[model samples]
Target: MQQLTVKEINTLVNGEVVGEYTGTITGLERIDKAGVGELTFIGNLKFSKKWDTSEASVAIVYEGIKIDPGAGKAFIKVKNPDLAMAQVLEVYLPDSPHFETDIHPTAVIDESARVGKGCRIGANTYVGKGVILGEGVTLYPNVSVFDHTSIGDHTTVWSGTVIRERSEIGKHCIFHANVSIGADGFGYRPSEQGLTKIPHIGHVVIGNHVEIGANSCVDRGKFSATVLGDGCKIDNLVQIGHNSVLGRFCIMAGNSGLAGSVTLGDGVVIGGSASIKDHTTIHSGATVGAGSGVMNDVGPGKTVVGYPACDSRDMLKQWVALRKLGKS
Candidate 1:
């Protein structure tokens, strides 16, 4: 078990300790559940007010919040308590599996593939012809890199992930288990033969520091690449359609989906279960609330909610009216 003194923890987060105490914190837990020898955090004023109820020996709190730490307890005040807690958690993060910087005997690498120095190709993994893997890339067991794909340095592809032909992935990106990249887009047209499938010739382009959760799918484009910009984070079970372009630092929560050609500007946040229609453009910093079905463009920094999503304020007014009608 890892333990740190209150003074040591305060130094780690550059926090000012209030109500001096010299107790050791063994672990971290939720504020409500934290007990003696445990550390907790109060991110907001409400949580700060509730500090008295928490049995934690030490807590990280926002700098300006005034809260009384009971006898023998201490509060470490930092600029942002939530971020401070994350820093502390990073210290406690367990070690991940170590790749041996060598290819497994069961792995298959084509003669035309180019693998960089210090790469690790796991058991039963396949590196197709003309694939270029940069230095320090790690492909876990059962991963497939199709022909003509290029993955940048230090990228890690977990088990069961498939990167189709011509896909381009940048450095330091992480693809969780079972993620599917570059599958053909869902495009069909009515024809004499009932329906004709539109062949997808394009691929996927993922930028640096991007993380895609397990079971998420990024479909191939019709003519151009489906793009995920730098630092984008996608949650589990999400679907990104063909030719969709996500700007830098965009975040899509679990179960959210985008139809074909949807464009999201930088810092856009799509809540869990939200759905965006085809050809819609959401500008920078826009937020789509959970369960919203977006049908039109959303301006920068705006928040929209409800089915057939509208401005949050307008949706709130409509909801109030509907509630009054129900009462009447």
Candidate 2:
């Protein structure tokens, strides 16, 4: 454990120290929750009172924040404390954990497959026939890559992620534990006698810098590619249905589910547990708040929230009206 002084902390973060850098800060936390020997942060001016009462040894504050210097806490001022905190954690939680580049003794690699240079295939991991994995790829324990699947350079698939046959995933992507990509889409049709399954005949294409969170599922298309654009990020337990198109830098929060054929434009943000109905097109830069249910197409750069999600203004008005009615 590296015990960093206030001076060392400022050097590491390039932040201005309002008090003596002699006090030692052992670690970092949040302003509302940090204790002794730890450094925490206050994101905005509203939390100034909270900063005064926080028990942390040092507080990382954004510029233009004014608080009592004698509040028994040191101040570390930065242009962007959140970004600096991220860098601090990176230095603390370095990814130097041991991973042997050699194929594990128990790893199963197909004879016809091309496993690239400087790769690590963990125990019980299966690399199928005709799979072409690029350089610096890593498959954690129990990963299953099916036949003919192509994974690009510098990709990492965490434990228990299943990549189905023929799915093409781009470079620098992450599939967290228990993620299922290229699985058969949920396709069913009603018949006179009973329900019949629609055949899923297509693959999934995930672009670079995309991340699929733990327990999330991205289903394959019926006859074409179900795609996620570059730099898109999916949160844990998300369900992306078949043939859905997610644009660049889009974000889906935890437990959100998108139905089949949904098209999200660039930088679309959906909150936790939000459900977007099938085939809905959320335009570019739209933001959907947590637990929203979208049944229509959302216009670009608009913020939507609530069930059958409406525009943010309308939703707030409706909530206010509902509260008034409840009082009456």
RMSD for each of the candidates: 1.9, 2.1
lDDT of 1 by residue, 84-179 (tens): 999899887767677664899999999999999999999999999999999999999999999999999999999999999999999999999999
List model 2 lDDT by residue over 1-328, tens digit each.
5677777777888988886445677777777788888888877887778866777878778977877545456788899988878867766564544766468899999999998898888999999999999999989989999999999998999999999999999999999999999999999899986999999999999999899999999999999989999999999999999999999999999999999999999999999999999999999999999999999999999999998899999999999999999999
Which candidate has the highest lDDT of all?
A: 1
lDDT of 2 at 269: 95
What C-alpha lDDT does candidate 2 achieve relative to the native structure?
Answer: 0.90
For model 2 the local lDDT of residue 136 reads 90
- lDDT of each model, Cα atoms only? 0.94, 0.90
Candidate 2 Cα deviation (angstroms), residue 72: 7.7
TM-score of each: 0.93, 0.92
